[model samples]
Target chain A: MSIEMTKAEVPGVPLLEVRDLHVEFHTRDGAAKAVNGVSYTVDAGETLAVLGESGSGKSVTAQTIMGILDTPPGKVTGGQVLFRGEDLLTMSEQERRRVRGDKIAMIFQDALSALNPVLSVGYQLGELFRVHRGMSRREARAKAVELMDRVRIPAAKERVNDYPHQFSGGMRQRIMIAMALALEPDVIIADEPTTALDVTVQAQVMDLLAELQRDFHMGLILITHDLGVVADVADKIAVMYAGRIVENAPVHELYKRPAHPYTRGLLDSIPRLDHKGKELYAIKGLPPSLTAIPSGCAFNPRCTQARDVCRSEIPPLLDVTEPDGTPIGGRTSACHFWKETIHG
Target chain B: MGRYVVRRLLQMIPVFIGATFIVFMMMYALPGDPVRALWGERAPDEAQMAALKADLGLDDPILLQYWHYLTGLLQGDFGTQISSRREVIDVIGDALPATIRLTVLAFTITVVVGIGLGLIAGLRAGGKTDGLILFVTLLLISVPVFVIGYLYQTYLGVKWDLIKPTVQDSEDWGQLLLPALVLASLSLAYVARLTRTSIVENRRADYMRTAKAKGLSARRAVTVHLLRNSLIPVVTFLGVDLGNLATGAIVTEGIFNIHGIGNTVFHALNSREGSTVVGIVTFIILVYLVVTLIVDLLYAVLDPRIRYA
Candidate 1:
């Protein structure tokens, strides 16, 4: 098999790699290019945080990779989603289905809406084991309780029979996490897992996720627009703007000096204690509408440092480097003047 | 669950009394004395009529008469029918089997055909099948029940001779099939529309997406997750419809000439047989009460969130 050959030939190849993924949504008005040539990688024991504003195609990209895109409206025009040297895009639906929730699992946002309200949490959680592993109902139920306990849900035995409405918001999100973690998947994609939770609970959920990722050593792709929430948990960050990744960097370095104007705008927009009295910075304009993205760089109209080149030509993602031409490891920026933005 | 049932049964006692009392009062309020109406254009001797009235307790006050009737009813003694000189209980016993057969057959057709078509239409919403279902249901709703009955009788019965125009044998399934279809037609339309709306609304729900993402097969996702939630409203509608089907459908019964409760009540009303009408109407009320209670309980079973104390 190609997987065996690739494992032998290419040692330490990324567990999952998304190469040049393009997804579009056809509407009555026009076709909205929701995801435009997104590319990212997730390796074992690594976390890739996809950061973006609304309409940035971060979630859409994840959906495409997971093969859960609503395809009548959304059409995947081009892409190669490589999972362990196999093209998930090219795979049959049956094979892709096997890979989902077994090889790779996903945790959705809005746990209340995501879970089946009629079914018990135990049944929903136990379903994965029953369907994929062919475990007896009793075995699956026992496994479900263990998963609940692992996620720190209080009195797992008692709560296993409880429905989604019975659980608190934090507990519900924990149950969602528990579902994703049940099978010990090689990779997990959590789409805005804490967006629906309180500020205090957000940190708790993130900590739990980080701990689980450590314990499982799974490749994690944490998708969110919150710059601060993913800081401690994410190893690397991909900043997306108007359906494209404008910057990809190791998380801490990007925070210190953002190589893209949009990333800088996002970083500056974060509220700080010292700047409490002063009016907070906000990205001046709204994100570009996907249906009518700018001809050049999609963020050109909103970029404060926009020039004629930025207006007329799309900037390719160039490698970020120092003034002396010493390259920064694992850094790239889609900006005409990356030097000015990062090291100026 | 047990407590809820007991509470509901106790509540039905008042309903039963009220329903029976109203029907009894209406029969008493009719212009002509039922005894006189029973004799058609024939002169009855004044002494004979008075003796018959005294014998039947018609000389007593209406309340006292109703009390006698209620007491007899409690002891499973429906009074004799004046016009036919037959026991009201015997007439009901003859009619109940026919009504049950029609109701059960119609209910099965409504649930199976209505829900089956609805699933087909809803699963393919915005397509040709959905449009066709919409048009058909609209047509069914617009046309009155009597018009459909006559048309089916004229076309399917008289002209084509596919089946008998009327029920020849009240207890026979073969003869009752056409009548049941006519009875079920309107309710089938409603169930289909209700089911389609629910399925369309829930087909793309977030939980459904979760089911798919969880790697659930298409069959399991629709049956276990989508259908379970969608059927809650449809089942509630079907519950009331089933009760209505069992006791109602007087129009269908008349066209088909089946000796069901509705027809029996109709014939009794025309002949001014007070005992027969009051007796059957009371029985219909009891059936409705028990059925609605069953529906309420079934709601809890279908949706765990709905708990009855």
Candidate 2:
């Protein structure tokens, strides 16, 4: 309880806030704009699901916020990542490092690759305590067992000595969660945590994550392309296309009526049991290459409702309203024809 | 592990026997008559030659002579040299200390310099230091070992007069230093390239990123997570090189005039001392077998994935 007290020091400031962030990868071809002017905020106990396809910069945004971006090829061209009103980008490397795995922990998508193959599970988990808290080896090991049991790994004592290869996929993910949870981080950015798990195991891991998030009251920014997964856990949904957030809204409102054509296409693309025999629906063209995104809107090429205005003039992200002009709070769409999109 | 070591030891027997037997055959197959060679250009009396051949077991068939040699070896007898008429066992014992000293010093230099350069180059990959290490190692590797040995002998030994032109006493560590370095140079290059490559490859591994994400300092991440995994292949290479250093450095020994196993074998082969050559070659084969066995055992210690059954 004392650990949770520090984050609430500033009442109005969110746990984490990203404002107009831009990231680019310097490829041989050109500087590819991986994340362009992306912004969002997540308070403690909130889950903001950043939804997008593989190259939509969803993971890049999360990585940038965590201060773990690979700097040589990838760079933060502009904007700030604020944790409790302190800009992470402006902080020194040593200061940022102190924040990592302590204030802002992360869980990677692939547990097998993320966890060191040679080290035992206990050692990896205990490392957090040893490094950040300066705990003794025996104390850290006991904390590791406590953490493993907290994640519900059966017989934590017996399995703690096992290597990463010894565990099943689900168990490995549980260990990953255990590691992320080890230091009781204030905010955890889980990048597609269940994308590699079995279908049945996906729900178990997601449920475990949700339960833990609730238990710890930590801010979670869940990044994934899975619409169904987002619908359940996310309080807010931010749909991204070509490095920009095209739409942001409360989860239920966005699903009830999408204000952006791209979000509509994504919702329609989800395969359903009722439409079993029908030819599946897919969006008209692929997402644009970051290096060569369209002038006005990055999604204009794939948008079915793209117009002459959309091709020439870049649309600012404006708040969405019902056809009768009843604006929904926090519902903004970056589209030239948001009115048409919502009405239709 | 104990059982595995015992099993591995037992497996070396056939390898040892096959190696020694081949050397025995090659010695007998050499194009000269051993007793006649021992007498030089002068002809001995026919009866005296016959008596000497009988005493030496040279008149017996090849298989019978091999059987006699094997029995004597099993009874801890390496037999007497037909050339010097000296005890073969005593000669090998005298040469061993020098070879061990030279090889051990050489191995130490190879490890320290090779691994240190590799770590620096790998950590600063694509930097100026990395390019310099790559250039130097490439230069070392392409030149032949004998050429390297001679160059060091001529320049550092004779021209500069920094050390003796040839080793005055093999037991004097300072005298053996230059020769040891020449022996170590090629293998040092190989180890550096291997360690650098391993370090570069493992540096990009996902676990290394995880280590950084764990709030570990860059030094801790590299030393604990990266170095341990990267050094496995380099250690294996080092093991094989250790075996080679002790026995296969005949050229270096010749250049330095060091009375080690290489020098002993070179003189024995030249004088057509069949028994002496066979005895010394057999001892070298044993050393190689023991070193390689130790290397195999070390593989398990370095990597947890490989468990001996």
Candidate 3:
């Protein structure tokens, strides 16, 4: 199948688009910026993987998009998240709730802990059908079994009556995926979806997601720090650092030539089978605290290309040029040495 | 699940034995003879008192008396109440239903009102609702149960004529309401506070966020995801308090003129009816054991992670 780039290729409008989103948490100490002017869009049937390390605001951005952030402590201070041309940030709680499970669903990490312990798997899975679709108990239960089967849960018919504790972690996650797909929502936000599972199971779950995405033709936002998983599932990649997206490019382009220094470091840090038994390069230093972000580029403190100018002036996401000086579609880094990094 | 219940039942043996032993020892340690107390100001002569004590096996050695009491307990015979010359079980049995009714009503009211207020308060913590609930619970808790009972009697029963004059006299909902409210007030504060803390803490659990992420409504997130998990601790507190209510609502019983186990115990003490006192204490211990077991079972059911072992 021929894959096309950019929002124009998609038949309908973007399923979800978040622009200049800034999420802050007010604490006794001060306001902590969790998500800083982050922007991305997922068109119909597109998979945009938000690739970032922990504490890099990947999950918070997803939460803001889903409208599930806790008020008081957590507040979305700025930006608009447009879902089907409606501003989700400004929607009333009731309207947002109506859209949540029915329009755009989210699959959380650790599905074993997410499902209710007391409730039967069938009951929990069937809840969406019963609540949002207004199906009867019998009908909902049948739909639940169908969902379980769709997610490849073994003995779906028999196991539907079991409780959450009875299912293994991988199975629980499959059930979570099943639940998320119940309404066939326009977008699915899988936040660190397979992080808690074993590698074998992680591959299986991600493959399941990809398979489901093709069948449903739904937009998928896969949020994770695992580049291998992202490479396998994502069509587009948004590399984040210190609560900001430093690089946004198609997956193949990003893998072939990572323009952002942080993205390059992340790509190099992974231990690949091609470099078997060699010492893996790890990105040095922890991610900067959002409460007190560095001046210049957020990654400049750790960036090897850092010059005096890189230390004082913050870098914006700029255009990356080809070897022939042609501009790529997506924004790259504003680091003065971006040409050297991309071409070298 | 069935095996779990069997194991729980077997575990109660040691508990009941320990309870019975303590009850027997404490009854003997108390000053003044039951036979003498029964005789009142006109003290029974030494020989008559001695005969009565022997007949009841109190004249036996402590070990012998304990063995007799244990045997009697096993045989479902608690001997006879000295003053009434009635079977101890019969006396407790007569009073048992009334006490149970009072306790059940009181407990239901306490949970309904307390949990309702607590949920509202906890969800709106740091808001006016939280402040109001805290104020009311603290206020009710500070005033002793008897004072609240008497106050209800004064205003609700005697003055404004909202309720009937006494618990015994009134058969209407209005009558039941005052007694239930009076008896429930003390426990209400504790339940409300427990519920508030539990719900607030439960809100912090990662699963709640997970539920929300599932795109579940806020109501479902709070009620199903948070409230059920939070209720385990509240169940424990309620279980213990229900035991106390069953055995220790003496003052409320007296103020309301209710003929229940609390009142029975009071009469037993005054009349120095040793058999009746022993019976009441033993029954109270049994009630506590049963309530504890029930709550534990409920906790296990509510939280699948909890196992008997």
Candidate 4:
């Protein structure tokens, strides 16, 4: 069977676009609105960092995009995941599967758990080529070694036969990256890829990922809770709280002037050498439960700038403007007082 | 690997000795004496009784008798059957092949049907098909094996004549089918349930999700990724049940009148022929030992993390 390649690249079209995505979990406790009206776009050669703490629906949106959500617990009630002009959510399962790992791939946080323990790393990597490309075992093995080498694995040829457990944590993460890169997909969604590694190894892995993304010019969606990890690599950042993107802006602009109080708290929480002796700043409250999100702006309960307007009415993701009222392109915040917050 | 095998073999020696010792002691402690059972309704005179005891070396001390038994066993002499007056090994050798044939066929059916049903059930978990399979397996597990065997014999053999009620000889393999099916039913249910549970658990594992993310079809993911890991536990259970399966042949054999080792042992137990019973029991123990060793070796094959030190 012939594999379907991604649709021909159109210069103006975004490589990947998610529009008005809504995901819910029909759990025994209640229906949880895990993702509500989330939207984003990634160009061919840019990294989009989805920043959020655990349970903020960042991974949920990513899973929905990949068509991997467990349906009984997770349902994509409304969404469109468009990859190269074709909406993946509307494709047949067979068609979607063809798109998965071929057009879009995902790398999980725990490399040790993600890789099949019983299989040799080479065999696991080679499976993509064999299944999708119909390559012979010998060809797959050669390609596996090449992919391993491409990911900067030391002694790739000798280690090809080693199982996942035989490799160190960082090496295993590299192997995961290598597997995702094997088919040369157009987009790669890495969900907390470095969360399980040591500090130094995390940097190495992130660096490798960033360098590879540049090499392939693939759209990279980096889903991470650690704000520090994405500052160097992300072109744009979307900060999620209570399953909603409260702030969206260019990475440098977000760091310089966070238009939402939640983003400002996240930026302040990061420890620095200059602020050594004091307690690190922490956001005041836990995220609202998805099952019972606050009525208006979900972040209102925790926002220092919360007003009666913030509590009574939901804030839309309005475009952020300068003090002189010139709109910043592609910058939006779901906060009523974003103008003040950005200028504060 | 060779060293591991040799080490496992060496370990089996003590187990074999201990098992044989237990069987021997249990027979000695049994209420009915083999001599009395042999002379049933015929009282032997004092002199005749004494002569018989001396002839069989029953007059020797217990330790000396055990020594003789051990020495004879070491030389591959399983002593003689008290009733038939034939060598115990010769009797077992004659019956062992029939038992092996019946057990192998039954166990093979058990594995194939069990795993197939389990795979279907696991893949369609929470669906109607999975519910039906689970309910049927549970019902099978709840019912006694003999009840199942007799039911099949009545309906399939006696009523429908799908299989011969009894075998004419060891070569009459066709007669073994219905009995084999009966024998396999309980184990099949057990294996199916175990496999379903294992596959369900493995299906939720991160690696399986990774397999799907790597663009594998769901069918391929379950077969290639989930099934192998799930079989590890099922294989272990099967290995441990090997002796139980062998002895299960006894009941099935008796019901069907198949002259297997199990049938011979059944008669020996009823007749209080300790030597024949001990010999067969020891042979079953050996089979169990060998099966366990094979299972341990299979672990290394199934999971790469397990290696022979």
Best by DockQ: 4
For candidate 1, the docking band is medium
Compute fnat per model.
0.65, 0.56, 0.54, 0.75
**Pairs of colliding residues, candidate 3:** none
Ranking by DockQ: 4, 1, 2, 3
lDDT of each: 0.90, 0.89, 0.84, 0.89
Best by TM-score: 4
Query: What's the candidate order when arranged by decreasing lDDT?
Result: 1, 2, 4, 3
Q: Write one digit per residue (lDDT tens) for candidate 4, span A185-275.
A: 9999999999999999999999999999999999999999998899999999999887788889999999999999999999899999999
Interface RMSD of each: 0.8, 1.2, 1.9, 0.7
C-alpha TM-scores of all predictions: 0.95, 0.96, 0.92, 0.97
Taking the tens digit of each residue's C-alpha lDDT, what string does model 2 give over B123-241?
Answer: 99999999999999999999988898889889988899998979988889999999999999998999999999999999988888778888898988988889888999998899889
Give the per-residue Cα lDDT of candidate 4 at A153.
Answer: 94
Model 3: per-residue lDDT, tens digit, A1-344? Answer: 11112223344556689999999999876888889899889987899999998888999999888877888789988999988666888877776777787788989898877777777889888888877888999999999999999999999999999988898889999998998899888899999999999999999999999999999999999999989998877899998887888888899999998887888999999888899888889878888877888988888879888899888888777888788988888657656678888888
Predicted chain B of candidate 2, TM-score versus the true chain B: 0.95
Report how far residue A172 has shifted in candidate 3, in Å.
1.2
User: RMSDs, each prediction?
Assistant: 2.1, 2.3, 3.8, 1.7
Worst 10 residues of 1 chain A by lDDT: A1-10
lDDT of 1 at A323: 86
TM-score of chain A of 2: 0.97
**Candidate 2 segments whose C-alpha is farther than 4 A from its true place:** A1-7
Error of 4 at A27 (Å): 0.9
